[model samples]
Target: MADAVALRQALAAFLGDTQYRKFVARGMYRGRMAYWQEQEWTRFTTAHPEFAVDLNELAAALLVCHLHGDELKPDTAEVFHGCMDLARWYVEARSRLFPYAAQDVISTEGRPFEGDRIGVLFCPACRVARAGWRRR
Candidate 1:
């Protein structure tokens, strides 16, 4: 139920923490930063049950943001905005029973790449929903 602002703030805080930076560094060195273990995700979800949806959405947004690059560019910024909007819609609509509803609504896949670097891994649903935002 958390909003995009809260999700962004939480993600920033989590990523800014020294421990997390070190964790990322270690993962990078081990070539494991591109993926997460199921248990690790479970622990994160267990610790922050309230932000689960937001966290998932934020992860997807960050990946898309990385993909677009140059956040200052108008087109890239639009992509970020569109991705966030799509994520909010996905969260709101996920509980309804309907025909042609999106499947695999949360991304469980490994991190998406930006050039040679590993970006954040996002849910499959968000990725699908944001496809339109990508530049031709």
Candidate 2:
């Protein structure tokens, strides 16, 4: 098994990668109008096989996060939970092969809101992952 710390770092790197960012941005924009080309997904999967599952989950989570904001509606909670589960798995696995990193620092910027057990409602990891997905 890969080291949890390394896996987290690698995930962070992948989330920060410029090409990955562009791919995700494109997916988010174009994805709404039509399905992504099989070739595009194939190219991405070929380039980052280790992240195939993660990317798929992230894409789903991003759509949910975008449509619903921090509020995880019942219909979208499954996707959100899936991303969180994947994050937990990666953290536990400690994989260490993160080759992609953003040329510039990736920021996790957002406004704060008040709520009971806000952390549970709007997880930091979820927010950062969403930001990475939305980043251009």
Candidate 3:
């Protein structure tokens, strides 16, 4: 319902500083500087109940951004094994991080294709939280 940034900040608060920093330290994010508060995040997610059901990729990006400071992109991100297949498409054929379909379609990460919802395919081989130039 809200924008990507909103989802990310709320996720950061929900995750907490230490855990949130992990994604950032790993170069999972692109570049960014922002602020957040757990209390506000609590309120937002609560109001948006669907958010409670799913939030893996966004959470990952939030952590990377807050810790690193930049937008969310692959080049700025730390590479992972076999991730190039997914990343090289550069955001699903460069069509945006999550693109929706007109009709009903199945998706992963607990986020069903419900009304303008976006989906992503994480490294199927590995969760690879530490995406840091593994493919040098």
**RMSD each, Å:** 16.7, 15.6, 14.4
Runs in model 2 with CA error above 4 Å?
1-17, 29-40, 54-56, 61-136
Best by lDDT: 3
Q: Regarding lDDT, does 1 or 2 come out ahead?
A: 1
Rank candidates by lDDT, best first. Answer: 3, 1, 2
- Cα lDDT computed for each candidate against the true fold: 0.37, 0.36, 0.40
- lDDT string, candidate 1, 1-136, tens digits: 5665554446446555553333322333232334453344455557667666643553433332222221111111111211223465555554322111223332323544234222233334434444533332
Model 2 / residue 49 / CA error / Å: 3.2
Worst 10 residues of 2 by lDDT: 75-84
What tens digits encode model 2's per-residue C-alpha lDDT throughout 1-136?
3333343335335555553334433444434412443455555447666645444454454432221223232211111111123365444322221111111222223334333121212333454554564463
lDDT, model 1: 0.37
- Tell me the tens digit of each residue's lDDT in model 3 across 70-122: 45443212222221233455344223322211111223334333343433333
The TM-scores, one per candidate, come to 0.29, 0.25, 0.29
